[model samples]
Target chain A: MKRSNIAKLIIALLLAFAGYAAFFIAPDEATMHAIQRIFYFHASSGWAAMEGTAIVFFANIAYLRKRTPKWDWLAVSSVEVSLAFWSVVLVTGPIWAHPVWGVWWAWDWRLTLTLVLWILYVCYLILRGLIEDPERRAAASAIFGIFIFVGVPIDYLSIRIWRTQHPQPVLFGGGGMDPRMKAVFFFCSGVLTLLMIILICQRYRLEQLKYEAEELRIAIEERGEPQITQRAKVKV
Target chain B: MDAARAASIILRKEVRAEMRTRELLQTTVTFVVIVVVLFSFAFEPSAAEARRYGPGLLWIALLFAGSLMLNPSFAKEQANDTIYALRMAPVSAFSIYLGKMLANLLFLAITEAILLPVFAVLYNVSLWPVIGRLAIILLLGAFGLAVTGTVFSAVATQARMREMLLPLLVLPILIPLMIAAVEATDELLEASPVLDRTWLMVLVAFDIIYFAAAWMLSDYLLEE
Candidate 1:
């Protein structure tokens, strides 16, 4: 069995366990009840998304400092995974919100900030696509990524200063959580973090494969030779 | 050359070139005026309604107009290969960024100066009472815009779809600035206005942070 397959299977099992714990074991909230179950996945995905972006931020910095293709790969992979998790956050957020807040979307700070963060990363990907040269694409995207990350705090602060319709932070809201619920929350977080790692690893491997493919294509184009397949096989 | 000296030299070069044409300024101001006029016709709001929503509308114009002004800042350098020349110079790359940023800031300030009175008259909002505070907010907000917009302009300059890409890259990143600027302007536009120190601080902090980030990371952005 492949190591990658093993990791994926482990992640899948953990996700299922987390979901079961969230829906079955965790006591229903006194107020929101069943729908609040979404909180487990929703909030955990949010944390994973943030973790993904934070990795992207560091990957960007490392790429600039070391100029390694691996750092660029890390940056791109993390952002792509982060986007997937952020989509989950966006989707699940509205699901939770609609039942509780009675609206599909809230213009509240965190929600709005997350939406904008998603946009910024999407633009980051677009910027990368627009540049043809790989080195330039990596460098340009790193700079843009740093700027986007810097803007995150500013976005948070602006929303904080100006009170909006969004609910206050519930995770650390200092409101005591039921002990079992807290356990479930941390359990969900742990599972999601593992999921994030698995996604990043898979994506990073995809990037490596892409780099190899590009190199093979370039070698074929330059030499007009049949060496590409053998080289690719050895690389794999 | 020293960073400040290099920056001033780039600033002077841009200003001199801009003065010769005034293309960016004229087009941006015209665009802004047309936008304001179109909004008036579209909404046709009463004086009270105008006063309420006017600041938001004004900043929207400024945001779009500032983007128009910034798009050309680096794109023009591409035409003459002047960017290459600047890159080859023995100056810190940050100097080039700061210089372009300063030039964009000046152009935006000029646009705002023209648009503010026009906005005041067109929207029937009195500007005299809040001019000082309004200037502060505009300066801070515009500084924020120019910092982020200038950097994005450089990145977008190399894109095939440079024109469309500039604003796409800029607007999302500038939301914090927009929030601070719009809310601060809203406070100033109120009948019983009190300048929100918090929003002002947000604007100032963002400007400083953004400018510093651009300065520090700029060397990587312009690489070939």
Candidate 2:
């Protein structure tokens, strides 16, 4: 095993511990007690997910326009990372919402937007699956990826502008965190961002290997004298 | 020939082609009006509710109808191998883009024009200010749509899910135009002060930016 991979594993383990500490070991909230504390991880991780997805989408656009492979690798990795974080957000939300809102999922504005954003991205991955050609797949997904990103801010704004009756944001001004809370919050968010980058690197390397293996398979098949793709000819 | 004549020549050629069968204009307008009627029947006829949803329904109907018209524009060219003919012509692809854009603008405008009075009666809102705002926003919005649409249409043609992919890809980027258009329309209907000269100027800036983009990128879309 390489050093960076080992370090990434260490960091991942640390994140798990920190996340556990934030949830259980941290001091109780002044108001909502056990439930509100979930806000720390839920909100921060959700924000991180949004950021990662945005970066993935942007990299996809750059890949499409420039016809570069590195951007595609960057994109697929970040999206997978986002899917993981999205799970964190989704899991933590029901735990928090069940006590506060008295329901697991309501048609609230925040939940709706997150749902739309998630579905939009799931469609992004499905698009990749449906296409046969890599370049075409990349270009099509890149375009849709950028589009989904544009929808996110507007989705956030639309909830604010329209009268959907969703609750206004609870956390304001650095979430009104106490000193101790702020320290832990900053620690988790920072480590998670770095953790995301490391995760993306490893995932990207795997995707590249997969792409190469696919190329080799195609090449072996073409050795039987059939042209598969105009692009695979040169790349393989 | 002069620039006006050259542009005019392109416009004339496009208009003539559409007028011969009228498929482009006919299908778009028919579908748009039907959509408006369907909206009225689907929702309750509350004046306030209809007023709020009018701009959204109007723009959405035009967009979907416009997409229908746009698909055949390029795919048909590939059908008869007319794309090579257009490519071999002395005229620039930018000219071709502008010509098609103008035709789309005309078709969309006519749809709005016919629908406005009917929508007004159904919703109990005046159509004049909306028309003025639409004149600026629709042309600007349609230009952005056409610019991006033509480019994407070319790209989608090579892909498997051209039908589904085009709208999925387009709606996200076009949200800004929709927001701006709807905001402008809302201000016009309610006569708000927020949408003064600056807002109209925004519409102008958007138009110029996208028109220039269409001009610059038209060739990239045309090249094999």
Pick by DockQ: which candidate is best? 1
For model 1, residues B34-142, the per-residue Cα lDDT tens digits are: 9999999999989999988898899899999887788888888889888788889998889999898999999999999999889889989999998998999999988
Candidate 1 residue-wise lDDT, A1-236, digit = tens: 99889989998998999989999999989998999899889999999999999999999999999998999999999999999999999999998899899999978878888889999999999999898878888888998999999878888998766657765656686677889998999999999999999989988989999999899888989998759768878757
Against the native chain B, each candidate's TM-score is 0.98, 0.86
**A183 Cα displacement, candidate 1 (Å):** 1.8
Q: Each model's TM-score, in the order given? A: 0.96, 0.78
The candidate maximizing TM-score is 1
lDDT of each: 0.89, 0.70
Lowest summed lDDT window (length 10), candidate 2 chain A: A158-167
The per-residue C-alpha lDDT of model 1 at residue B18 equals: 90
Question: Model 1: which residue pairs collide?
Answer: none
> DockQ of candidates 1 onward, in order?
0.79, 0.19
Query: Which candidate has the top score in lDDT?
Result: 1
Q: Place model 2 in a CAPRI quality band.
A: incorrect
